[model samples]
Target: MDALDDLDLRVSGCRACPRLVDWREEVARTKRAAFADQTYWGRPVPGFGPPDARLLIIGLAPAAHGGNRTGRMFTGDRSGDVLYQALYDVGLASQPTSVAADDGLELYGVRVTAPVHCAPPENKPTPGERETCRPWLVQELRLLRPTVRAVVVLGAFGWQATLPALAEAGWRVPRPRPAFGHGVRVGIDRSEGSVGGGGPAGLDLFGCFHVSQRNTFTGKLTPAMLREVLSTAARAAGLGK
Candidate 1:
């Protein structure tokens, strides 16, 4: 297991962010039986991929009834179901199902991470919390060296968190990085003080509307669109047939 794997053991009852801790605990009390005996992994969910994973999926934060409750990123949620199906179809996952934490699913060469590890109230994390949670992401990126070639940022928040890391590594992001439509690729280059974002950043950062309830409910993103994005990203990552 990578260092990322141990985050659950380290801080499930994390107190780093007081607001998140209180909110998660509050939910745990009301829905105790629903999550009976299950450890609320309210801590940061680390990246789940091999050291040499080619694609990195960055999400915003954990869901209260989802990742925090199930102890797996994106599990026990609708968004996860869609995301996992697309991932399996793209040949990056070893299993086709991601219904629950113990669904016996596995990723082949991709890892999913959230900008903020803790599940935020109403699924929205404040700016301060996002900032507080970013250091873990940076650490994970550093340990995942020589393997991450591309990143699929799920939303604007995720995109924002990941861009600076790429830029510091010498990947130049085009001004504004344009807008958030899928299948778009803007270049990234390290700015003047970007120590981590230097050299020939082989990572291709793809932006997509988050696989969230809002997008799914509004029909803004379809299953086909998700599959297409996954296919494109996987081919770029050299995982496609």
Candidate 2:
């Protein structure tokens, strides 16, 4: 837990990507009209949840006015509304809403994080930026590897980013990696010489559509759909019903 705390501090101070650094700070400075009176957490956001979590939820990136302003992954965002509510429905989260960092929300047996920690321009991080920020995810997974048995990746971008991070953390990913799609599931084996031992009995990865406004508003991802995936993931992680 101390190590995870240290990693969070390290992540908060990172300025490896010049573009992301400038953009995140600029948004903080300019301020959105609705959030004019609030100060933004204009730095790389850290993963949130218990260190011994068996279920891991991976997202693409933070929303500019959402996490960038609140300092918590998925907080103060429309996407978070859908995601958290579904998590709550499945017994993974204690609450259905996440408004601010200190909103008294708690996750049970689950951790929420993103591939890219900082909020990017247009809600999209460039390929280079993703690669630059990859090490953080790698280190985070390394710390959580022992307990994390089920990973729920939101969107194809998260799926792609997470696979490499898992591999770097010693999980043996299949060659010609499995493609990402809503409800897709892939079983990853741990390397023989890896921390947890290599075998068929390893982590289970699940794919789900991102809880973005575009997806939810257009019915690309519904509340019931997200709950189903999360419930399945919880069971896979041995969290029980």
Candidate 3:
């Protein structure tokens, strides 16, 4: 198997965080009222996208009823509804909706991952849990660094998590790292281990508001707002020609 596939297998089997492991399993066993008939993934969710993707999207974590149930990042949730539509509008996704893993929704030049793989209680992972989950993200970035030209961080949490992971994956992040804000952009020097291994000098990072229900329902994040950010990043990543 390829490195990405092997890493995904390892990620799926991880039970390093006791709290996360228990919570995820319990949720799966109990099942949500609306999804009681469906089986849950009940484990660490792996990143999804083409192996050669140039656009990387970093989200906070799997939603309890979304990824934790569907086993695909950003699937089966309101947040995903907003996100996938924007990606579709910008020509990144083949379809505007991602209802399930086998629904045939495809991302053309992008990959989606999260800092925390497992769903957390109250939709928030504790600081210790976030730290424990860091290694997986660090390793994933190491694998993607070469091909990834641009990264879109979905929220401040993802922003904070990605900067360190990028550094650990050998990117030279700025010392004072730029603050996160909607449409914020930062450039970081890529190291020798990157995909091209020689010429490409840097990677661009873009920040966007999280597509959570709170944001979408409150008008804090609209389709046009998200499309603008994604389209710009996609262009920077050399996608959507």
Candidate 3 has which clashing residue pairs, if any?
Answer: 146-195
Q: Write candidate 3's Cα lDDT for 3-34 as tens digits.
A: 99999999999999999999999999999999
TM-score of each predicted structure versus truth: 0.86, 0.96, 0.95
Candidate 1 per-residue C-alpha lDDT over 40-143 given as tens digits, one digit per residue, 9 for 90 to 100: 65555555556667778888987887887777789878899889988888777877667666778889888888888887888889988887777677666655
In candidate 2, what residue range of length 10 has the lowest lDDT sum?
Answer: 192-201
Model 2 Cα lDDT, one tens digit per residue, 89-179: 8888899999999999999999999999999999999888999999999999988877899999999988889999888888899989999
Q: What's the C-alpha lDDT at position 163 in model 3?
A: 90
Worst 10 residues of 1 by lDDT: 189-198
In order, what lDDT does every prediction score?
0.73, 0.91, 0.91
RMSD of 1: 2.9
Q: Which segments of model 3 are wrong by more than 4 Å? A: 192-201
C-alpha root-mean-square deviation, candidate 3 = 1.8
Point out the worst 10-residue segment of candidate 3 by lDDT: 192-201
Per-residue error at 79 for model 3, in Å?
Answer: 0.6
Total clashing pairs for each candidate = 16, 2, 1
